[model samples]
Target: MALFSIQDICKSYPGVQAAQNVSFEIDEGEIVGFLGKNGAGKSTIIRILAGVEQPDSGTISMYEAPCTFTMAKQAADAGIAVVHQELNDVPLLTVAENMAMGLGYPKKAGILDRRALNARARAALAELHMDVDPNALVGELSVAERRMVMIARALLTDAKLIVLDEPTASLTEREIEELFAVIKRLKSQDVSFLYVSHRLKEITELCDRSLVMRDGHLVADVQMKEIDEDALVALIAGKRKESLTSKRAERTFGDEVLRVEGLDPFYRGSPFDLHVAAGEILGLAGLGGAGRTETIRQILGANPNLGVTCTLNGRNVQITSPKQAWDCGIGLVPEDRRNEGALLNFPITHNITLSSLKLRRSRNWLPFPSTGKEAREAEHQITTLNLKTPSAEESLANLSGGNQQKAILARSLSAGCKVLILDEPTHGVDVDAKTEIYSQIMRLAASGCAIILISSELPELIELADRFMVLSEGKLVASLNGEVSENELLKLCLTANSEMVA
Candidate 1:
């Protein structure tokens, strides 16, 4: 008998079927990969399983005995826990407190047991080889650290079936290996995992079998060894697709568009100098806390003016804030889209026009945005990017994770930025969406838009970037001109960080 099972699950929204007749089961100690494109009903099915949403009609069973969950707590009681792709963390709370959210507070003598909470949370983090302080505020942790914190919180529970959605979208090579080791160790104790990720490589590495969904339907289910990554892509896409690496072209670039000097004082050698050309894709490679995102943040003027000299298009400019960076023709698609990029309550029109509100005005002198102009501009980007949304009036929160990411990218496009910085731009998106995004990036580069891309996936860099800059602990370690193997790049980054830690 299967350990946990859901049969004929169905769900629907206003205009989307969401999920249709989805059926799957997980055996004891099994790790099943739930593979699907964004909005393909995977999230819906997971939500129903987590008891966040009730299926229109279906049966859930454990050990062949039927059960139903009407609330998230019910699912928790039944040993079902979900770590969603979009993190559910309280920024103001400490790491231990966040980890204790649903696990219940430890109490002794009618008072909160703070020491017990920290000890438990610290143990969980250590299992994943994370070095985060349990008493540190969640908001102060790096994005990768926050991701690990969420995973650790889920582990703190005594879950029988743990569903990890894009669990490694932010982790580095070292962290991912540590997590996989922990998962394998847990599996020996009969723990089951529903591993969800867009990185097919992880699916191949960690999952025993796979379930593929497309257009709200569970289209294919197969053993991992029986199907290759290309076949998996074909199944999820509902059509055969060319290999992404085959799309690579010769390195090309125009004039240098941006230049920076003295950004990092850690280098005792020559002063750190960085530059990206008008039509170049510069891939910034690093481990977590490796200063990949921080470098870009400094360029965008998020930190204090730290003796960092920046020159844009051959002219020196001072960027004092993110808005100032955008005003000066630099647009950023942040790594954490849910919290940093999107306005969940706002319409797609407003969100898309956020960075380039001036472009949506009826006239150049208009102080207020023109509604018609904004709608038209937003619609253009929606169509151009193939953003799957009901309408421009739809709230950004309502769309799937990939569509929300696309909308944020559209905002950068609307800004008509001269230099664009994409930090994990395709973090949680689907494979087809990844291809489209890659195409759009190449098109932008061809159109003379200087791109500084930060991707955790080394293959993406190998496939699209004209060059690569590896960072380790706020220091420049290596710079590869082109065509570097994934293992080689990973080794370069890992070796640097390992040496730094020592």
Candidate 2:
């Protein structure tokens, strides 16, 4: 018998049919990959299965028995656990307390037993081969570490079915390997898993079978061995070829468009100099904390005023603030879009026009919400980018992971920016969306928009960058153009930090 199954489930929200007759099943000891565009009912189905939300119609069964659950607690008692895309740890609480939420304190006095709680949390971490301190504040952890805590929480519950939504979204290679090892062990223990991810390579590696969803419909359910990346993409996108966006044109660089001279950030570091030419795609490659994002932020005036100076279009400029950088025709798509780029509560239509709302305002400097010009532009963006939202007026947070990313890119491009900086544009986006975004970036570069791309994925930089630079410990260590390889880039990033230490 199937472990758990949803049959012809349907759900609808105001102005959106979030899910329509969506159905899938998991088997014992199987890792099933769930693939879909953002807002294509992935979260809705997960919510229904987790008993966080009820479907408008249809039935769910557990072990061939009809089951009705109205709360997450009930689902947990039924051996189901869900790790959401965002961590739910309490910032003020220690790792142990946050991990043990809802479970009573191990003492009769009602005062928390810190030692026992710490020991349990430590044991969970040790099972995953992690060495984090259980007493550490949840807020003090990195994104990757916080995710590990979440996984540990689920493991402690001893749930039979685990749903992981973008589990490795913020994880490094080693962390991901550790997670896979844990998953493999659980599979052997007859604990089924529903793995949702945007990375196709990982899906193939980790999943036994895969299901693809589109616009709330289960489009395909097949074994992982039967599909290649291209076939999988076409299955999701509905065609092998589409006219939405194409690859960028190859072009020669013009004179220096941006120059950084003796740029010293807030930390103690040696000064460095680098230059970007007109229409050039400058790739900044480095490990997680090698200062690639910091360097770009400093150039775009998002960071504190660095001691060094920079030049834009041959004119010496002081970019002390983000507004100053904008005035100088520089735009940045920050690394953390959820925190820096999009307002989660706002509608897509509003967010798309936010950066350029000033352009549409009258002399009195008041926005005209009813003008419909911004609405038309939003629609244009939706069509041009092939965003899969019900409408632009829908809340941005309602969209799926990939569509939310597209909306962010649309907002950035709407600014009419000259020197554009895209940091990890494809982060958490699905394969179809990744290809579409790459094509869009290339087109932007071909239009004389000097581009600076900061990415940890070496193949991306190697594929799109005209010239690549490596940052190590807040300094530019190697800048190479033409015939660059991923091996060279990784080596530079690894050595850069140690070089600074020396």
Candidate 3:
């Protein structure tokens, strides 16, 4: 008998059919990879299975016994746990306190048992070989550590089935290795897993079997050994994607549009310099935590005390805030779009026009906004970006991940900035969406937008950038012009990391 299963689950919202007859099962100790394009109904079905959402139709079975989950707690009580992509945690609380949430704190004679609570948290962390202080504040933990903490908290429930959504979105290579090790170890102990990720390589590495979702339907179920990454990508996209590279033959750049000098992205690290000309894409290449995003932040006015000099269009400027950065004709599409860049619950029109509201206002100081103007511009951007949505008034959260990203990009584009910084722009989208985004980026650069693109995928950089800058430990390790290979970039990063550690 299967350890857990959901049969013929169906869910709908407004005009969106989130899940249409989705059915799947996990055997004891099996690791299943869930693959789909954005808005293909992968997450919707997962939510139903994990009790985060109630299916309009369908049934769940555990050990061949029918069951229902109207609330998340009911699923938890049934030994099921879900770790969402965007973590929901209280930063002010300590690691132990955060882990103890929902689950009651340890107590003795009606008094909280702090030692026992810490011990329990420590034990859960130890399961993943995480060396974190249980009493340490969650706010101070790195993203990688915070993810591990969430996983640890889930395990505390003695979960029989675990659902992980984009578990490695922002993790370093080493952190990913540790996580996979823990997953394998847990699987050996008879723990079942449903893993969701856009990176097909990770699916190839860890998943025993794969399930593909398309248009809110369960499309295919195949053993991992029987399918290659290319075939898997094709199955998810419903079509093969050409190489994600610009089709332009030659590129021409104008005068220098943005430059940074003597900026230190890392604490007490050597200062570095960077510049981007109009109509150029400068790719910043590095492994996770190699200061690519940090460097971009510094240029956008992080750590002003470091005496970093930022020059735009040949004039020196002091930018201390994101608002100021925009005022100076600079824009950033942040890596963490959900938290930093997107307004999920709002309408697409609002999100698309948010950064450029000044353009819609009758006057700079006027509270009155031109809704008609905003909608027109939003529609224009939507059509230009090929964003798939019923209308501009549709709520952003209702759209797929790729469309949400498109809305964010539209926000940046409408802002009419000269220098644009894109951090991990294609992090968690399908091949089709990624290709669309790449084409839009190329078009933007052709229209004279100076671009600084940061991507973990070396092939993206090799194909997109006119030149690439490599940073390691916050230092400029290499500046490669002309052609470069993915292996070369990876080797440089690994070798630089080893040398620095030594």
| Per-prediction TM-score to the true structure, in the order listed | 0.94, 0.88, 0.91
Candidate 3: residue 284 Cα off by (Å) = 2.0
> 396-439, model 1: which lDDT tens digit per residue?
98888778888888888667789999998888778777777788
Give per-residue CA lDDT, model 3, range 336-380, as digits (tens): 787787888899999999988888886678876788889899988
Model 3 TM-score on a 0 to 1 scale = 0.91
Poorest lDDT segment (10 consecutive residues) of candidate 2: 241-250
Alpha-carbon runs more than 4 Å astray in model 1: 245-252, 265-271, 361-373, 497-502
lDDT score, candidate 2, position 306:
58
TM-score of 2: 0.88
Of the pair 1 and 3, which is ahead by TM-score? 1
Off by over 4 Å in 2: 103-109, 126-142, 241-248, 262-268, 300-306, 361-370, 472-477, 491-502
- Predicted structure 1, TM vs. truth: 0.94
Candidates sorted by TM-score, best first:
1, 3, 2
**RMSD of model 2 against the true structure:** 3.4
Report the Cα lDDT for candidate 3.
0.84
Most accurate candidate by TM-score? 1
